[model samples]
Target: MELKWTDTLDIAIELDEAHPDVDPQYIRFTDLHRWVTELEGFNDDPERSNEKILEAIQMTWIEEKD
Candidate 1:
């Protein structure tokens, strides 16, 4: 499935699987943005992301990690 900015939980799950050794809580938003865009199934516009979206993604990732 193609990923979108609003797919925070799904994106988090994918990131969790992709980077199992990394801690989401400690990740920088810049790195998180890059990772999300690089995700295999991600097809959304990279420019569409904002701070709020990134934060949601990070929060979801942290939750998924635990």
Candidate 2:
């Protein structure tokens, strides 16, 4: 499925799988933003994301890692 900024949970899961060694809690928003955009099937406008959306994705990723 195509991923959008609103797909925080799904994006997190994908990130968790893509970078199993990563600790999402410590990820910078810049890196997170790049990673999300690089994800397979991610087709949303990169410019559409903001701090709040990045935070949600990070939080969900942290949860998924746990």
Give the Cα lDDT of each candidate.
Answer: 0.95, 0.94
**lDDT (tens digit, per residue) of candidate 2 on 1-66:** 999999999999999999999999999999999999999999999999999999999988888887
Model 1 clash pairs are none
Report the number of the highest-TM-score candidate: 2
C-alpha TM-score for every candidate: 0.96, 0.97
Across 1-66, the per-residue lDDT of candidate 1 in tens digits comes to 899999999999999999999999899999999999999989999999999999999999988877
**Model 1 compared with the native: what TM-score?**
0.96
Question: lDDT, candidate 2, residue 28?
Answer: 95
